[model samples]
Target: MNRNKSLFYFAAFFAMVIYGISTTIIGAILPQLIDKFRLTGYSAGTVASIMPLGITIGSIIFGPIVDRFGYKLLMFVASITVITGLYGLSSTSSVDILRISVLLIGAGNGIINGTANSLVSDISGEKKKSRLSLLHAFYGIGALGLPFMLSVFSSVVSIREVFLIISISLFLLALLLVFITFPVAKKNMGLPLSEILKLINNPLLLLFAFFLFFQSGMEGVAGTWITTLIQKTRIDNYNSALAALFFLILALTIGRFLISFLLKHFTRFRLLQVGLIIVISGAVIIFSINNYYTTITGLVLMGFGFAGGFPIILSFVGDNYQSISGTAFSLIFVIALSGSMIMNIIAGVISDTFGIQYISILIIACVFIMFFLLYNLNSKMSMK
Candidate 1:
């Protein structure tokens, strides 16, 4: 039983690694895709947006399926879907096929990501925050690892070859899933309509969902635009700009591990409050400082600031809604992804019309809004 539990935890962590890789791969190889396909800015944006659409669609449906059917089938199928997508991406020449492949990857990742988090929450009991934080830390490993891998291998290997290698790895993971014994379905056959409505109408749930909204937005903007902002304000070199983005993710990854330890010493709410303060300070530094080192420092601080929100909030949701965790997670993820999409659009428009530097301003605004939401959420949670 102990061995089985360990395997379950390993599977969850492995799934998150896939999640991190699939989500970041497009960004890592976008330049190659653009060069190969001769894609225009508009076409590239359209292609990029399709992934999130796929993710949102996948997020909307995974909860009920997982709750009713259990983790094994959903995870296995999602793994296969992602593998097919990666293979398709490596082999396809047609842009139409490429888009479909991207969609598949996104959808598969959404299912895997949601299911893994829900599974951990169910298994961890009272240790959800620390466990989730550690789970997400693996995600950071994949997120940070892939680009570094690409950079190292780019000169020696073709991008298609890299995709094939990743696909092969995922195929092995899929096979491993077939042998692992997953926990049984939480709901027997179906979730009643009343339960669905109750989850939707729960004010505390909604509060947590919306708090994630701004949190996701802030993260989306920072991840998407920080490089551009760095280039516009502090550095002109592309590699240097990329390094700034790298540091942000690196800091985030490190911060998660740190938070996992720190949770033992502090309340999640107090940690969250401290994180917000750190985020505000980081945003100010980015907005006001012109030096490269200072900007990178600010990005690092922002990364650390951003690390605690999802794990902490999702743990709260998991703790409170254990019976229907899959559905609850689905709701929050869909809402959170919507926030990501909306904020990316806003940042793009603002960057185009005003200046790229305003991206920092937008991040600062979102963090403040998150802080407001977090305060209210704390009060509500306390009452509960």
Candidate 2:
């Protein structure tokens, strides 16, 4: 890579890392917020759900913005919004304010994510998916690393202070992007909503959407339930279970980084097929085993398999249809976000009714759905 491209990649990766921390830190700090606010169960669930809800809505708005206005403007706006929202969250005591703050932060992050990935795809002529995977891997790295960094302060400081620090970091990054030059986005005159809606008629895109929907759900399930799944083994302590969850996420982050290197030598379909097989085997192991080591191993395998999915699929959309990249991203993200939201809710319901053990079963079932989608995708491609 040339110096300019290298710089852009680094900035994109750093930005993604910063954004990842913004989203995942909430998972760790939410319990503190709940205790601090004395929130009811339903109230807390509603509060927690606001971000994904905002992301779904944000994608709708951002797609047109990115398609029409270009990356730099959208990135600047998104970064400022998220930084401000985080600052707002840090200063707020009211639950209503916190909800609104989270909504802004979530929406900002979602827009930034979409814009950055779309930009990466635009620049990467031949190696689109590979580079996009690396960018996303950095996101995974931040998601894995930032929590541990935040945990160091959890015992010593308030969650508000943590958000304040994150807000500062976001501001700095936003300023940096403000000064950096980016390539002009292609002029798109299409109706973003109509273009996105039109993707439904494309069989491959529809099949890919289902694959991603299940993939996103499986990821959310693993993030939420892995600790519980490990603890149910009765051999590991809670600390170990938590460690397993981090390991799983770290594996995913690192896996995407490794995939960037491998993409030069492999086809997208080939890599995806191998990944699905690994995920299926991992799910099976997780469901059948009660041992901690085996469970952690299985989680890691599944994480690695799932790591490149979203970026690869998004890049695929961008590569195939230049005129409708924004619309494609919006539609695909809606499907993925919906699956993530619904599956998370389902995991909670299943855990409450059938016990936490059923979450692992649910995850395994989602993996099967992934298999079915991938199978159909592969078949269709083969026939083509």
lDDT of 1 at 23: 78
lDDT of 1 by residue, 1-384 (tens): 778889999999988987887877666665567678987544554566566666777788799999999889888889888888888888899999999998899888889889999999999877888999999988888777666666565578776777777788788889999999988898997789899899989989998999888887787677756655665578766556667777888888999999999999999999989998898888899888888999899989998998899999999999899999999999888888777667766776776677767778888888788888888998987887
- Write candidate 2's Cα lDDT for 40-80 as tens digits: 43454456566666666667667667777667777777888
At residue 10, what lDDT does model 2 achieve?
Answer: 69
Name the weakest run of 10 consecutive residues (lDDT summed) in model 1.
40-49
Q: Which RMSD does model 2 reach against the true structure?
A: 3.1
Give residue 264's error in model 1 in angstroms: 1.1
Candidate 1 CA-lDDT value: 0.82
Q: What lDDT does the true structure give each of the candidates? A: 0.82, 0.73
For model 2, name the residue pairs that clash.
none
Model 2: worst 10 consecutive residues (lDDT sum) = 229-238
